[model samples]
Each structure stands twice: as C-alpha cells, then as structure tokens.
Target: MSTFGDFFKVTTYGESHCRSVGCIVDGVPPGMELTEEDIQPQMTRRRPGQSALTTPRNEMDTVEIQSGTEFGITLGTPIAMVVRNKDQRPKDYGNSTMDMYPRPSHADWTYLEKYGVKASSGGGRSSARETIGRVAASAIAEKYLKLSHGIEIVAWTSSVGGIHMFPPTATHPTPSTNPAFLSLIDTITREKVDEFVPVRCPDQAASDRMAEEIAAFRDKSDSIGGTVTCVIRNVPSGLGEPCFDKIEAMLAHAMLSIPASKGFEIGSGFGGCEVPGSIHNDPFILAPEVPPLETGATRNGIPRPRLTTKTNNSGGIQGGITNGAHIYFKVGFKPPATIGQAQNTATYDGDASGTLEAKGRHDPCVVPRAVPIVEAMAALVVVDALMAQQSRQVSRSMLPPLKTNKPEIKAMVEDGP
Candidate 1:
C-alpha cells in the first residue's frame, strides 16, 4: 500500500507529470496548529533546480491545504495538501525509444511488467517529485512532534561517493547547568555545518578533496551517490510497538520509500555484523536520580537504566524497540542513472540501436537533496511511533507524564545557525 503508519496513516497521490501531487494525512489530532507555511520550507529543500548539482526542472512546489484544517488548526479530519507541477518538459522525453530500452538501474522495466503501462514523461509516479507530498506531510508531523513532545530529527550527508567524515562525539553537557556549555554545542553544530558545506564532511581537508571529485565527475558527464546519516535524539523509550510494527521496521519502510535509496541500516548497521555479540551488545546502567518525591517516583526507581554500551553496535535499537538513546542510521544511494554518455539500447518499437545518449538535466549526485528527504522520512516515522505510543489502550495513570523541559529538543526546532 502507498499509505503507511498504523496510528497516523499518510496516503500520497499524484505523479511527476500529473496536474499536481499531494498527500492525505488521516489521523492528526484535532486542535494542532498547522499551516501551508509550516510545510513549505521542506518542499523547497527537496525541490529540483535548487543548485548546480540537481536537475534543471524548476517547480514552485507551493503547497495548498485542501481540507482538515480550519483557521490554521486541524479539525480531526483527513488533511489534504497539494503542489502544482510547473516547468514540466514532456518534449524532452519525446523519443519513444524508452518503451523498449529501459534506463539501466531504473524501475522502467519492472514497472512495465507489473503495471502494463507507465508514465512516459519523468518516470511518472516513480519520479522524485513523488517525495514532495511525503516531505510536506512530514513537515506537519515534525511540527507536531516538536511542539507536543519536544522530539527533533535532523539528517545530513555523511559521505559523498567514497569519502566519509566523523560526526562530533562530544555530547552537549547539561546546557542549563552552564550557559557557556550551551554556546559551545551551538558553535560546534554550526562549525560542523560549515565544514560539511563542500561535501558535508566534518574534516575540512577531506571535504575539499570530495569537492574536487564531485567537480571532476560533473565534467565527465557522470554521476555518483553516497551515504546519508540521520540522528533522532530525545526520543522517549516505548515509542515503537512490539511484534509487527517495530520502530526500526517502520523506519526502514519509510526510508526505503525515498527515490534512489537502495540499502538501509540503523545504529551500527552493517558495520556491526563483523563484531561478536559481546562487542555489539549495549549494557544498561541505573540513573543517578529519578522523578521528584512530589512526582511520586523513586529516585532509584527501576534503576532508570540506560544503555551504556561504549559502542553503538546495535544502532540504538534493542529487542525491536527504542531504548531512549539517540537513534542513528545510514542510507545508501546509487549514482543517478541518467548520464550523458551514450549507451547501447533499443527503440520503443523494439528495434535495436547502436548508441543512445540521454538529453536532459540531472544531478551528478542525488545525496544533497536526499539529505532533507531522509530527515523528513525519519520525522514521519518517529511521529507515527509517538502517535502509536500515545494511542495505546493502556491507561495514562500507569505511565509517567511526558516531560516538557527537554533542552536538546529546543535545538531541533530552531534552524541551524
């Protein structure tokens, strides 16, 4: 099914070349404040033609809310949002030869066999444009998660082509305990953003090399792909369901839905496969203190245990559930398939051809635009998890009420400086 989530169902519709593309959110709680502006920034981030590295197809990608909101607040009805498609160049794909000679590494061949017909222009529903609705819907979900639960999600390119950069390891010590500590964290995150500007690498020299490689590849009329790492911090434990709809499973489902995504791993991911169980396991430790006496919870209550594993070999997930640790994961993308180099192919009528060259604007690498898409999908997954957790049949009295003073969450709502 194109729809996802058990508690908060999101159905995306329309095609790349269609009149418009949009999404329908079925289970957003009533009284949540939402607006078209809240979702536009995300669409702008994923829209093509934003920079030199992406396709030249320019789309305004302005979102329009059709229903489910009254005076900027949700009404507990299905929320529908649409983005009109502009700058479509159907003539660019006039050659019917694609009917027989499918683009290598694309869904053309399989889609034809499965559906008997496909959109001739821009790969139709399979186009990256399909992600517009997803990003828009996810923007609303993100706002809700932040405003209601203080959960924040962010993603960035960890590697391009084959270059990899180490993320910052110094945890922001209690920001409230010292104002200077908070400033330090903010400075580091900003520096990291700047260091990664050329290639999203924290290592300056490595980033420079990566930029050189990207420029060289662009000159060669070829494209490449790389890895995207996402971090979801301040996620409360127990958000994921047991048995079928586990957190990681749902996250994988959402991430794989992105265009050009081929592989997925959480926490340690594939790297952990080489380590033994002893090395991969996360050890639990008791919290120093617990809820206040007025809150009626013991300071050492249940140990308030945390996964203190020195290494995150399991990717912050244990027993198919979140363990209140930062959830980290990586996604792999293959090079963009539309290259300028000529290749052997056939005509639409099945006639053989010697060499065919593609004629259209395309990215040398899709990782940059994909970074926000990854973050958006992750936000959707976590928000849906929170929805599921909140909607559980259990009584609220059995669990501690959510805390609103989470400081790490504030960083998520504010844009990167």
Candidate 2:
C-alpha cells in the first residue's frame, strides 16, 4: 500500500523527523543514462526554503544514489536514493502541548484512532517531506518517458483559491480574467514555470498577484489553498488498460496521494460538466505524424494517434484511455494544517479544553511547492502505464505459435492419418 505504480514501482522509506528519507525505484530500463544530477533538480524544487512563500526549514536535500546504477547508466534493478535531514527539530514541539491535544484539522487524532499509536511527528508520516522520495524516483521515470516516447509533463499554479490565472467563462473564455495558458499548452516549459519563483504561475502579471496574496497570508500567520494544472504532451495512444487501469484513473490516484490534496480533475473537468454535449465533445481530426524526438523529426514505428480533437475538451483522454492528445489535469491542495495561529481545542483524552499553538516551518500555500510534485506524480503514472502497454504490445507481437493453435495441428486433423 505504501508503494505506487505496478510497473515503474517506487517504495518510499523513512519518515518525517527521521535521519533521512528516500525511495527504492524499480522497473527502470537497463542501459539508460542516469545520475544524481538527473534527480536533484526535482528534489530542489520540492525542498523547503527555496523562496519566501515556503517553509523556512532549509535542508540541502542532496540525494545520494546508493545503488542500482553503474557507469552513469541504470542497471534496470531497484534504484535506491536517500536524502539526510539536517534541519530537523523535533524539540520544536516542546513549547507546544501537541502531545496532550490533537491540533485541529491535523492528522493527530485520526492517525491515533486508526493506528492506536502514531509517530512522534503525529502526521509527519503524511507530511509533504514524504514526497521527496516520489519526486526523486519520478525524475528517473521522466528521463525514460522523454527518451522513449518524447513524453513531456509540466505543471504550474493555475489558481490560488479564487485568484485564477485562467478563470472560466461562458463563451470564448474572457482573457480579462482568464490568463489563457491554454494557448501556450503545447509550448510551455519548466524553465518558463520556474521563472516566476515562489508562485510558479508562468504568467508574469498573474504570478505577482498570487505572490502578493501569499505574502498577505504569511504576514497574518494564516494559510490559503490553491490548484496546480499539469499537462502531459507526446504520450503515445493505447497506453492505458481499459475497464480499470484507465490513464485518468491512475493520474487521479497519483495526485490525490499527495499530502493536503483535496480534489482532482482532468481536462475540461468540472467546467465541461456545465456545457452542452454538442459544445463540450472533442471532435476528432487527423493528427499530423509526430516524431519520437523533437529535434530530429522522424517516425519510429510507435503508433501515432490517427485522430485528434480540434479542441481538447476531453483533456487528451477519452473513454478511460489516452487518445494521443496532451493529457491535462489539476490538483487542489488545502492550506497547511499546522499554522502558527492559536486555537482552542480538546486534549487527547477529550476531558479538558485548552489552547494549542503549533510549531515548525510550514508553507502558507502548498500549491507553489506542489508544482514539481504534481509533475513527478504524473511522470510516475505515465511511465507505469507505458510499461504495462509495452509489456502487452511486445508480448503479443512476439508470440510463438502454440501447440493448440498451430496450423500444422489443423492439417494433421484434416489428413485423418
């Protein structure tokens, strides 16, 4: 249950306030070029103290590739990665009565109720720190997906509560409020997303507003929630398994697993629910052949999506499978539960009511930090689905004639010797 992905599986280890945290990623293809550098950027993105909007707890978060790689290439075995905790301060809880009373809206109560005994960090096991392993592992998956299928996954802050870069509208999506990233979906890059540091919104004017709002929350010792939009480009069609293992379903599973995530939506999502079927349906059109590598455009026998929609209202997925369009989705993250604000709450025994002030560094808004994490999760889901389809496709194509199905057996029966 702790692990994710059937094929590109990652089992994360360690806990919050622990010596270190990391993961063991399995199912990576052999001979792929990989190194610690490939994994560090995502960890750095997910790490705290990168900007004023995030938590102040600064850990270098440097990863060490312990095993499963050799000569700058993956061994196709389990890849082990670890990052040590240098700034951990469990003693920060000494001033507060966290041990006596469960922080309101925190996991302290539910975890105790479920497991009977919980870790010292209470909800630390479910902390955003846990996702460090996921991001690291996904870096590997991303490398493979990019090389094999030219798949590119990028995510950014689409909205901070009501401050949306692209506000939905009735007709034509008014540009006044809707900062239409839709137009730039095909070209948006991680470099552009990171350009607006702390907010990561991509749009300059909109990003400034989002940053200001976060600053307001930070100054007031409060927090806010927001949504992150992600798009996956160049995924080959026929990657998903129907009836259960749909691409969107797997994407939902990966996104919802992130800490503080409240809701998940894909491609048109809730907005499509408002429009009529005639307007909402994505009409299919012939897709121009796409090359496996962008620099050198040449066919590689990977099935090109024969048809594409004029408008991606379906978000690159239809009927629970990928249709070779850019798959887009959004994840909504709730405000950080551990705030500096004082509140009146009951003790662990529920016998007495008292005030509790939470401690530790926490993000005022998680969406800014969650951008790369969303991308990481998307990569994991895509890589896993791709592997599944590859296994099925290769096995079926390379099958040997079975004794029962062989034509020679049919000929013998006809001869009646």
Candidate 3:
C-alpha cells in the first residue's frame, strides 16, 4: 500500500526512529546515468535543522545507493536506496504519556486502532521521515523527465500562516491566480526559490513576514501551516488518460499523499470557481516550435504539437490530457500536531484526564521544507504519465515502428514486463 505510481512505481519502507528509511524504485529507463549526487540536493533541502524555522534534530540524511546500477548507469531494474537514522529518540515516546494517550490531531489514535498496536517512536509510517524515500525516488524520475522532454518542476512556499506573497487585494477567489505570479512559471528555478531559505517564498518582503510569523509561533510553543505552489514546464501535450487518471488528478493525488497535506488544487483552482465561463476558458492558438538545446529534449524525433492556449487557466491540462502548457498547482498543509504546548486530554483507558506536554523536534512552519517534497512528488507524477503517453503514442501511430524501426530501443522498452 506504500507503493505509488502506475508504471514508475516506488514502494517505501522503514519508519521514524527505525534502523533506516528507504525505498525500492522500479521502472527506471536503462542506460540512464544516476548517482547519489543527483539525489542528494533534494534530500538535503528536506532535511531538518538547516535553519531556525525547522526542527532542531540534525542528521546528514545522506542517501546510499544499494542496487540497480552498474558503472553509474541504470540497468532497467529495481533501484534500492536507503538513508540510515543517525538520531533515534524512541524513548521520547516511552510508556508514560505518548504510549497511553493519543496526541491530538496526530496519527497516534488511528494507527493504533487499525493495527491493534503501533510504533511509539514518532508516528511510525505516518511520520514525515517516510517522505525521505519519496524524495529520493523522485530524483531519478526528474532526471528521466528532464533528459527526455526538457521538463522542469519547481515549487515554493506561497503562503505561511496567512503571510502571503501575493498582492494584498488578492483573495481566495484567486488562489495563486495572480497574473504576475503565474508569469514566473517558466522562469522560477530551485536556486531562486532556495535563496530565501527557512521560508522559501520568492518575494523578499513576503518571505521576511512569513519568517517572522513562524518565529512567533515557535516562541509560543505552537506550529503553523502553509501552502506550496508548484509548476511543471515543458511537459509534452497529451499525457494522462480520460475518466480516471487525469493529469490534475494524478498531481493532486501525489501532492496530497505527503504527511501533513490537507488540501490540493490545480491552476485557477477554487479561484476559477467565481469567474464567468467565458473568462475562465482557455482559448487555443497555433503553436510555434523552438529548436531544442543540446541539453534539452533528447530529440526522440517526436514532433511537438502545433497548438497551445492563449491563456493557461486549464493549468496545462484540458479534461484529462495535457495541453503542452506549464502545469501549476497549490498544496495546503495543516499545522503540525505535536506542538510542545501543554494540553489536557484523556488517556487510552478513557478514564482519568491528564495534562500532556509534547516533546521532540518539529518544524514551526513546514512550508519551507515542503518545497523539495512538492517538487519530488511532481516529478514522480510527470514521469509516470510521460511513460504512459509515450507507449500510447507509439501504439497509435499510423505506421507501426515495432516491426522495422530501432530494434534496440524497442527491446529496451519491452524489457519492463
């Protein structure tokens, strides 16, 4: 059940305070160059203790490649990656309070009820530590997408505790719909986003405000939640299926899977709801082709679609398929539940009441750290959809290449099943 993706699957293992947390990644393209170097940047960003806003717990969170490569190239096999837990405080959840009483808004109660027993250390499978596997696995998917289609995914903190980067007049009616913000879709890069670390919102003034808000909450022994906006660029049109696996649906599915995510929305999301039908629609116009760079789209000779939209209110997708425009979306995260503030709650026996004082390292505001995670999940969804779309395109061609063209390439794709 921990597995994700249809074609490019990842099954994660281990838990917080466990010996190690890792994943088994399947369906990577063969002959692709991969290494820990490609994966470490995102892992480092997701790691805690980088700044005052994040949790104080410190670990290198370094990734080790266990299998699925030879001479630094993928062999078209299941890739296994692991990150050992250097800091384990299982005793923090000792038999006293955490073991007897379910922390409010945490997974403690639900997990115990479901399994009849649960890991007292952290929230077991529900901890944010579980996402280390996802972030690592997505790095591979990102490489493949970038090499194959020139795709780039970048996400950043958009709002933290209501300290938003958007203009003041902007309202929920235009959630991330600022024409200026949307214009940054292709231009924003990870380096630019990370420039304002601890609160990765791109706007300097807004970032400062968000940072201050997080500090206020931290001082109060509480936590705050925030939103992340992500954009996917250079995705070939016509990825994603009808009825079931819409690109937006897949994106939402992947984003919502992160530990604290509470809501998911695609371009013009709830905001578009208030606009008139004529104003909300994206009008199609003929597209112009641009020559690929040496590092760009691996020149598979697949012709780019000749049409695009005057506006991207559809968020690069129409119905279920992509329209070759950049896809953008926002994810909402709830406040971290295990705040250190003292609270009165009942015990497991439902008998006597008690005061609980939460302990452990937790981010006051998780939005900054969530940026890499959002990008990683976006990479997974795009790569999986890219594989599906390519297979379908090959199948539908008027002249079948399977019989006469590029036998070696065909063999490589065929090896999966």
Candidate 4:
C-alpha cells in the first residue's frame, strides 16, 4: 500500500519519527538528467516552518540522493532518496493524555483499530511528514513530464474556511463560465503563486483575507480547512484508463490520500449538476495549430486534439480521458484535527471520559503547505496515465492494419475523428 502506479512505481518508506523518511522511485527513463538539486525545491515548499501560517517545527527538509543516478543522469533504475528528520519531538506525544485517549477526528483511533499498534509520535505513516516521499518522487515525474511533453502542473490555495478566492455570484455561478477564472488558470505560474506566500493564493486581496483567517484560528488554538485549485496544461489527450481508472477517479484517489484532505472535484464538478444539459454540454470547435516544440519531440508526434470544447465544462476530460485542454480541479482539506483545545473523549479502553489537551506543533491551516503536495500528486497521476497510454499506443502501432470494407468506418479511421 506504500507504493503507487503501475509503470512509474514509487515505494515510500520510514515514519514521522524515524531517523529518515523518503522513497524509492522506479521506472524513470534512462539518460534523463536528475539530482538532489532538482528535487529539493518541492521538498522545501512542503517543509514545515516556512511561515507563520504553518507549523513551527523547524525542519530544513534537505534531500539527499542515495542511488539510481551517476553524475546526475538517471540509469533507468530505482532512484532512492532520503530526508533526515532533524527536529523530531516524540516526547511531545509521550507519557500524557495521548496514551489514554485518541484525539477526536484524528487518525490515532482508526490506526490503532486497523493495526492494533500506533507510532510513538505523530500519526506515523499517516502524518503529513509521510508526504515528503510523494513530493520528492512526483518532482521527478514532473521533470520528465515537463521535458518530454511540455506539461505543467501548478496548484495554489484558493479558499480558507468558507472564504473562496472566486465566489460564485448571479453573474458567474461557475468558474468555467467566467473568463477571468479561465485566464487565471491558463496564465498563472508557480512564481506568481509563491509571490503571495503564507496562503499561496495569487490574488492579493484573497491571500490577505485567507492569511488573516488562519491567524485568527491559530490565536484561538483552533484550526480551519480550505481548498487548493490545480491546473495541468499542455497535457496530451487520451491519457486516462477506462472502466475503473478514469483520470478524474485516479486524481480523486490521489488527492484524498493526502493528510487532512476531505473532498475532490474536477472542472465544474458538483457545480455542473445545477446547469442544464444544453448549457453544460461542451461543444467541439477547431483547435488552433500549435507549432512543434523546439526539441521536436511530442507524445509520439501527436500534437493536440484537432478539436476542443468551446466551453470546457467537461474540464478537458470526456468519458474519463483527457481531451487535450487544460485540466483543472479543487481539493478540500478538513480542519487539522490535532488542535490545542481541550476536549472530552473516552479513553482507548472506552471505560472513562475526560478532557485531553493535545500538545504538539500542527498547522493552523494546511492549504499553503499542501499546495506542493497537490501538484505532486497531480504530476504522479498525469505521468502514470501518460506512460500507460503511450505503452498501449506503441503496442497497437506494431500490429497489422485492419482490412475492413466499410467505407464510412474506413474513412473515419483514415482521417482520424
């Protein structure tokens, strides 16, 4: 269960309080340039103590390459990396109320029920620290996706508690129908997102409001939840697997796997349900001809779809497959459960109830730090789906051509629908 993907497999190891926490990444294409420097940026973004909105745990989160590369070139082997836990405070959770009662809405209760044993500090594998491996491994995938396909994945904090970056109104009830929202997704970059740090929302007004909201909660010893919106551009069409592994379905699985994440929505998502079929339908229009890349490399010489939707209510996916348009989604994180407030709960034995005041370093709002994790997971899903689709295309190319006699079918096949 620690590993994910069929082609680009990643097996993460270690725990929150372990000496080191990292991952083993397999299926990297040989001869690609990679190194610790290429991975450290994302790790730093996901690291704690970046700002006042996050946990104050001072972890540099410096990454080290253990294997699978020589002189910065990938050997197509398993790449191993590690990050030492420098500021571990296991004693914070030891010899206190934690031993008697499980924190409400925290993983402490379910983990004990599942494994019958819990880690000495934090949530063990369930901790946000475990996401270090995912962020590292997905950075590698992001590099590959960028170099080979010109794909770009970017995520930013879009909401805090109930305050949204782009609130729906009578004029624009859905973001897909708003040109401003569409333009933002198309042009927003990581640098712009980071410029408004602490909350990571690009809009200055929204970022300020979100930051104030988080600070208010932190002062109260409470926590709040928010949403992160992600956009993937220049992605090739026909990337997702059918039946079970739809692109959106896999994305949901990946996003929900992150600590504190509670909900996932793609494109119009739940909002589309209110619109009628006539308005919700994405009518196809001719896509502009894009010039070839400077590298002259594309996903098997397939540029992009000849046709695209006039209105992308479908979110660049049709019937679970990417449709060569920018794919966008939002992930909702639940308020961090491990607050500093005292609460009445039954002990592990369920015999007695008492107030348990939890003490430890935890984020008042996780959306800012969660930005990189969301992008990382998005990159993982895109890379895995791209590889799977490429494998099928390569295999299908080697087969004999069909000898059918139906003119309509043959013409459609020859011309490409």
For model 4, the superposed segments whose C-alpha errors exceed 4 Å read 290-305, 408-412, 415-417
- Look at candidate 1 and give me any clashing residue pairs: 97-348, 196-200, 267-315
The residue-level lDDT of candidate 3 at 195 comes to 92
**In model 4, what lDDT does residue 107 have?**
85
- In the range 211-270, model 1's lDDT, one tens digit per residue, is 677677888999888877777776776678777878899889888888899899886665
Candidate 3: regions farther than 4 A off: 167-172, 175-177, 288-305, 398-417
Model 2, 1-417: lDDT tens digits are 679989999999877788999999989999999999999998888889988899999888999999999889889889999999999888876444778888888787888888898777635688888999999999999999988878999999988968988877786342211236567687899999999888999988889999999899999999999999999998877678888888899999899999999999888787767768787777777766644432221123233335677778778888888888888888999988888899889998785659988888889999999999999999999999988987875676465633435676744432110
For all candidates, the clash counts are 3, 0, 0, 0
TM-score of each: 0.83, 0.90, 0.91, 0.95
Candidate number that wins on lDDT, 1 or 2: 2
Least well predicted 10-residue stretch by lDDT in candidate 2: 293-302
Error of 3 at 245 (Å): 1.0
Ranking by lDDT: 4, 3, 2, 1
Ranking the candidates on TM-score from highest down gives 4, 3, 2, 1
Score each candidate by Cα lDDT.
0.72, 0.84, 0.86, 0.89
lDDT of 3 by residue, 1-417 (tens): 899988999999998999999999999989999999999999999998899889888878999999999989999999999999998788878857776688888888888789898887888999999999999999999999988878999999999987777643545366445667767886999999989887989899999999999999999999999999999999887689888898888988998999999999887887888878787788887776654432222224444336688877788889889978999999999999989998888888885568788888888878888899999999999999988977775665544334325767754532121
